[model samples]
Structures are given as structure tokens and as C-alpha cells.
Target: MPHRKLQPGRLVLASHNAGKLREVAALVAPHGMQVVSAGELGLPEPAETENSFLGNAGIKALAAARAAGLPALADDSGFSVAALGGDPGVRTADWAELPGGGRDYTMAMAKVAALAEPHANRRAWFTCALVLAWPDGHTEGFEGKVHGTWVHPPRGERGFGYDPMFVPEGHSQTFGEMDPAEKHRISHRARAFALLAAACLPGAG
Candidate 1:
């Protein structure tokens, strides 16, 4: 399919996560696109019934685009561990959902550590699936992954989610420790965003 040129307009970011919104907003900043969060618009978070990242991302993007009557961008991201057979993959976000309420990454990291304790292969990766959808139902998708290992006692406090426990293949610091600018440059989201820019904004990256 030919690349879809995204015209300048208000694009809804189909997410309530502050960190994701910030990173994605920066990635698309050069394209002159105005990014707004679903939360800002008071749009409801759609049920992510899909099993795959791309499918879930499309669900959110489509829901937001239709509700806001504007083009929308959404992403589904998670961590996969080789030892755990990529566990906490699609379940990454809810892995630490408290029994009563709330999500906790600290517990999530602890679970990962416990599961990976006996395994010699600590190889893992972060996966992100990006989707863009228009009000009319047109959509585009991109995927990106970054391989690395899991660390114990979770390090740093800069990034969110599994960042503190993930050490990218070539980096000394976990994603949680690295500067946001540096993380964005080599992040799974950044890789997907590059593809999105090439498709929708031509030469914008």
C-alpha cells in the first residue's frame, strides 16, 4: 500500500498513559502534528480484547478516531522474556494489577525476577506496536522491538513500567536510569515512530 500522508490536524493520542504520551508526542513533534490525549478529550478507554499488540493498538486507535471524529494514534507495548517464554508480554500492563485495585510496576518487576531466578537465559525484549487510524476507518500499523536482559532489584527511577528492570543490549544503564532523550533515541517506541513518520510525514524523521 502507498504511504498515507497525514494532513495537519488535531490527532488524538489514544492513551491515558502520561509517559507514552510524552514520548510519542516528542517523536512526532517534527511533523507539525498536534497531539492530544484521550484523557484530555474525556474519551473512554476502549477494552483491549485483542491478544496481540497490533490488534489492541488498532482497537484503541479506531475507537478514539471514531469517538473524537479525528485521526488517532495508539500504541501497545510490553516486555517479553526468553526464559519465561515471553511471559508478561501482552499481559505486561496488568501483570501487577493489585487484587483490589491499581497497577504496580514494582511488583511486576519482582515477579519477573522471581520467574527468571532459576533460568540461565535472561534474554528479553520490549515490543511496541503503533497504529494510526482515521475517522473514516483507514488505518496503518508499525512494530518495533529491542532485545536486552532483565536486571535484579530494579535500577534507577527515570522511566516507568519495566524500565528499571530492563537493560538494553548495548547499554550499561537500564531504561529507568538513562536520560529520556537517550532512551527515546533507542527505544522500541522510537523505532516504530520512525516507520510511522516515514509513512505519514515523508522525510519528517
Candidate 2:
């Protein structure tokens, strides 16, 4: 299938996460697109029933495109620990699920550390699957990952999700400790967006 030419215009971002919205807005800003969050448009959040990041990203993107009748972009991202045999691959946010469905990364991070304490391998990686969907169902998916090691007593307070517990290889500070600009340069989401931009944005490649 020919890639859909994603010309600049209003695009619906299929997410309610403030951090994700901010990151995505920055990524697409140079393309001359007006980003509008699905939350702001009163679009209902869609359930992520898929078992993989790419599946979930497609689900969200398609849902938003159908709901808003506009092109949509979505991402499903999380951490996978090698010691746990990727036990939290798709359930990263729900592994130590919070009551009332809120995310508690601090508690989740502690749980991961405890589970990984006895293992010699503390290796882990973050994966992000990004999707862009058109109202007619033409969709594109891109994925990226950042390998790192898990740290106990999670450091920093800047980034969200499992940032505090992860220290990228060759980097001294945890992502949560790094400045946003610094983190963006090496993040999984940024990597995926780089590919997407090269393929979809004019003059970006």
C-alpha cells in the first residue's frame, strides 16, 4: 500500500495523557499541523484490547479517526524487563494497578525492583509503537525502543511513567532526572516520531 501523504492540517491526537500530548505536540509542530487532543474534542477514550503496543496504537488511532472524522495519531508505550521475561510488556501500566484506575508509577517501580532483586540481569527496555490513521482506514505504524537498566530507589522527578526507574545505557542520569530536551533526544517516542516524520512530513526526510 502506498503511504498516506500526511499533509499539514488539523490532526487529532488520540490520547488523554498530558505528558504524551505535550511531547506529541512538540514533535508535530515543525510540520505545520494543528494538533488537537481527543480529550479536548470530547472524544471518548477507547479501550486498548490488543495484546501488543502496535495493536493498541492502531486501535487508538483508528478510534479517534472514526470519531472525529480526521486524521489521528496515537502511541502505545511501556517498559519490558528482561528478568521478568517481559511479564509487563503490555501491562506495564497495570502491573501494579492503582485503585480507581489511576497510574502509580512510584508503586509500580518499587514492585518491579522487588521482583527483579534476586535476578542477576537487570536489563530492560522501553518500547513505543506509533500509529497514524486516516478516516478511510489507511494506517501507518512505526516502532522504536531504548535499551536501559532498571534502578532501585528510583531517581529523579522529571519524566512520567517508569522514567525514574530506568537509566539508559551510557547515560549517567535516569530519564526522570534528565532535562526534557535531553530526554527527548534519546527517547523511544522520539525515535518513532523521527521515522514517522521522515516518511510523512514534507521535507523532513
Candidate 3:
């Protein structure tokens, strides 16, 4: 469906991360609206009490939209390990429950490695659930996931939060070893963002 004509003013991204702000900024900049994060406006970061990724995403988006008095987009995502019984799903961002905590990809990988009985059963995927809620009470949601297998001990210094251990479907290298553009093109977050852009961006990229 076509976007319900983007509202006429500033739109906020219901997030506190610089990375997320940057991504959402890029996604909505072309739509003629300024996209800023809750942090940028000195707004309080809301706690995510929702059980599921989509639930949490909607909660944030709706809260921010109400707070900013503008349409808002929020996303919640995680790396779920099959062998680990889908652990780290809702807690992906909450890893250590601190700022920059999710950047500890090594720690994340170690935990997953501990769970995998054998080397081959360590399969997993990154899932992203995004919600776009407008000030007018309108909303849109999309979820995307990229399948991959863990890289045992993890590798590389690039990316974060399990990137070093995640080898996308067919690629021989991990997300940490790949360039930003390459990862963005195939990442779960990227796919999720792409869906939002295509469905709600109008002319956004």
C-alpha cells in the first residue's frame, strides 16, 4: 500500500543509538522530513517491557511519536541462535543492559559457542522488527531476518553484537569481515529497513 502521505513536519526515530539514528535519517531524509532520534532531543529512553520484538518496536514508536508530536519509526531486533533455543532474541540490545553493551560481539559469540553442542549445530539468524507509527495514529510494521551459522570463536573487528560470528547464508566470511555496504545489503536490519523504505518511504532510498 502507498504511504499515507508523509505528515508535513519533523518525524522522529524512536531510538537512542547513533547507528539507528543514522540509518533512519538516511531512510527518511529524502522524504523531505527531518529525522532525529529521541536522544538527539534529550528525551528519555523508554524501557522495553514488551515480550516480542514487534511488540517492543511498536511500543517505542508509539511512545516517541506521542512525545515528539510527530510520526516516528522504531525497531527492535535480535540474534536468535537455534541451538541455544532462540536465545538473545528480545535481549539482543539489552545484552549487558548498558550503553555500548551490544557492541561486545565477542561476548555474545562466546555465549552462543557455549550453547552449541557440536560445531555444526550452531545455526542462527538476526531478526529485525520495525514499526512506523504516525502522529495521526496510523502505523506500519515490518520484520526481516537473515539466516546464518555461528563462527565458533568469532572473528574480525568490524561490526558488532555477534557480527564476528555470523556468516550469512552463503558467504564464506562473517559480517565483521565484510564492508559496511556489503553487510547492509544483506543484513536482517537492512532487509527490515528496506521493507519500510519501500512501503512507507515514498521516494526514500
Best by lDDT: 1
Give the per-residue lDDT digits (tens) of candidate 1, residues 80-179. 9999999999999999899998899999999999988899998999999999999999999999999999999999999999999999998999999999
RMSD of each: 1.1, 1.0, 2.8
Model 3 — TM-score against the truth? 0.87
Candidate 2 residue lDDT tens string, 39-158: 999999888999999999999999999989999999899999999998588898787677887778889988888998899998999999999999999899999999999898989989
Q: Per-residue lDDT tens digits of candidate 3, residues 62-82?
A: 888888888888988888888
Off by over 4 Å in 1: 202-205
How do all models score by TM-score?
0.97, 0.97, 0.87
Clashing pairs in 2: none
Ordered from best to worst TM-score, the candidate numbers read 1, 2, 3
TM-score of 2: 0.97
Ranking by lDDT: 1, 2, 3
lDDT values of the candidates? Answer: 0.92, 0.91, 0.79
lDDT of 3 at 161: 66
lDDT for model 3: 0.79
Stretches off by above 4 angstroms in model 2 are none
